[model samples]
Target: MTEPVRRRGRPPRAQQDAGPGMRERILDVAREEFAERGYDKASVRGIAKAAGVDPALVHHYFGTKEQVFAASIEMVLAPALEAPAALVDGPLDGAGERMTRFFFGVWDAPATRAPLLAIVRSALNNEVAAGVFRGLVASQLLARIAQRLDLPEGEAELRASLAAAQLVGTAMLRYVIKVEPLASADLEWVIARIAPVVQVHLTGP
Candidate 1:
């Protein structure tokens, strides 16, 4: 009797079944793969193996490796993507504080921060990853928040981008670079100072 032909780089038969949340499962593994191996080295087969499914499954869910990487980017930025809600949730009087607080809230939590750090590292290291990160930040997160700002056509985007820059720069200094004073400072203390600036960006004439 002939033995079953095992395709090269495929996971075991027992691992072939894609159960519930398989797409998310694949993405989680893809993040780790990209985080560790980087964009150039990470492959569909490797992600699938780590995900306990076939390589075809990763392609099935995300289309291509780049697409998978984009999806992973979206996953890490999901919380920040929801910032528009914070804008609309209450009076514009407190929008800056609300937005600033919300931004750090996402970063302060360990669950989201780890993947975020991986993504930021990848973005800084690879142009492809950086492009994907930039596109998503502009289109999905910034554009949405800009619309909520209720400013004139071009100005809204400017305000949104500036506010985002402030938030992102602070995060980079505090979390990524671990710069002294800022890194060790209290979260509320940081937010107290930043929220006003964000409010100005969004609402000041």
Candidate 2:
């Protein structure tokens, strides 16, 4: 009998063994890769190699590098992203307070802070990562808030951008920089002081 021929193109054993959570595993590895390598340097092949799967599988799940970045952002910012739903039906006057509280709540939660901090740190130091992050915030977070505000196009964008500046600044000081007083202060106290600023930015003339 003739010897059997081996397959010409087969995945490595690692790829064949990926389990039900392969998508999540990809995201986890992608997060580290993006954090370490920034957006421009991180590659699908590298992420797949770290994730123990084929590059084809990464593409199969995420479609593109940008999509993978968006998914990683969504995973890190899920709480804040969902917080906007609370604004959908609430009084416009209180939107700022609600938004402020929601953000602080997410930041205050021990479970969510690590990934959030990692993203913020990476964005601060990496221009490519910063662009990806800034786009996500502008299109997803600020744009959503602007829509709910029902202001004119120009005014809404301005208001949302201002409010975002306040929140992002606060996060940078309190979490990333670990500034004195603000970093160690009580969560409710910080919310009280910052919410009004955010509220004015959102609704004040």
Candidate 3:
């Protein structure tokens, strides 16, 4: 029998043990790794070790540390990225309230908030993490919502950015900084106060 030749970069499958859940496990561990170490210190080897997989598998799945960090950011932001759906499914009349309520609802949920806190902390301090975070938020989340709005070419983006600023600033105080009154206030209470402003940003002149 002739000998089989292996590809240059690919590790042997036996060594990879890349079962169905392996990729997700690596990502979950990577999130915690980046959260703990920040972007500069987190490494493929460290992430692989944490996930009990080979470093090659991490590279194979995510390409590099930056890519891994980007994936982690997307995972945390997945909930928020669905904002356009709320805009599309309902009348534009209450779109601002829907958007506001949806944004906080994701933050208020315990399941999404934990990983979100980790990614947000990393983005706050690391330039690389922050860059990736900003790029994804603009392209994936805000751009989609902007497209859903009826506006002139450049104006939709501006409106969406304004609304995003409003929501993001409020979230920073309420969730990240835990400012006393705002952070402790009821979710609906915050929504009632903020949604009107967001509506003005989105649909007002």
Candidate 4:
């Protein structure tokens, strides 16, 4: 042996020109891919190949396909952080009703509805997406609202969850499912009818 080849740490040729926002690009591509293909059939390698980056980068940013699904979801779902407080605070006498109306109003605009419907459809069809959906709804909307209401013995969670089912189901039928009158109706008209029901869900014993 004349000499031992020494390997020094250096950038690999594959990773040399990885562009900025590469991870985000992969996620964006993956989101569409997952939406189109659903979770089971969507492939990480295919997403990376389309994204023009190494597969490692995908794992680096998102860890796994499941994690990628979670990342994809953050784009769609709005966490109900400020809304609950805004709904409860002393702006109006019918706090519960106002809260309900405000909550529904959040998804009324296209900006809110677009990502939401995409994610909902994906989750409805895929278990991985469903888990992600469940997690986001629980953490952001349900738990926070429960805390705000000062619910006792976790009863508030059931109340909030039932309310969520109603609201989510309505969104599904009207927006995603595109069921007749509910979908065709004007926004305020829809809000007027739904607000009281949601108010009862919030304040009911």
Which candidate number has the best TM-score? 3
**What's the distance in Å from true for residue 190, model 3?**
0.5
In model 4, the runs with Cα more than 4 Å from the true position are 1-20, 78-103
List clashing residue pairs in candidate 4. Answer: none
Query: Candidate 1: what lDDT?
Result: 0.86
Question: Across residues 1-205, which tens digit of lDDT does each residue of candidate 1 receive?
Answer: 9979877655456555656688888998999999888888899989988977778777767887879999998988876786666665688778788888888988999999988988888888889889999999998878877777676889999998999999999999999999999999999999999999998998998
* Full-model lDDT for every candidate: 0.86, 0.82, 0.85, 0.71
TM-scores for all predictions: 0.87, 0.82, 0.90, 0.81
Model with the higher lDDT, candidate 1 or 2 = 1
Could you tell which candidate, 1 or 4, scores higher by TM-score?
1
lDDT by residue (94-169, candidate 4, tens digit) is 7556765765676677666766666787788888779988997788767766665556747878877777777778
Q: Give Cα distance to truth, residue 200, candidate 4, Å.
A: 0.6
Q: Cα RMSD (Å) between model 1 and the true structure?
A: 3.0
Q: Give the lowest summed-lDDT range of ten residues in model 3.
A: 8-17
Residue-pair clashes per prediction, in order, are: 0, 0, 0, 0
The digit string of per-residue lDDT tens for model 3 on 10-123 reads 656875666778788888999899878877788999998988877877888889798999988877787678656666468777878988888888889998887888878888
How big is the positional error of residue 174 in model 2, measured in Å on the Cα after superposition?
Answer: 0.5
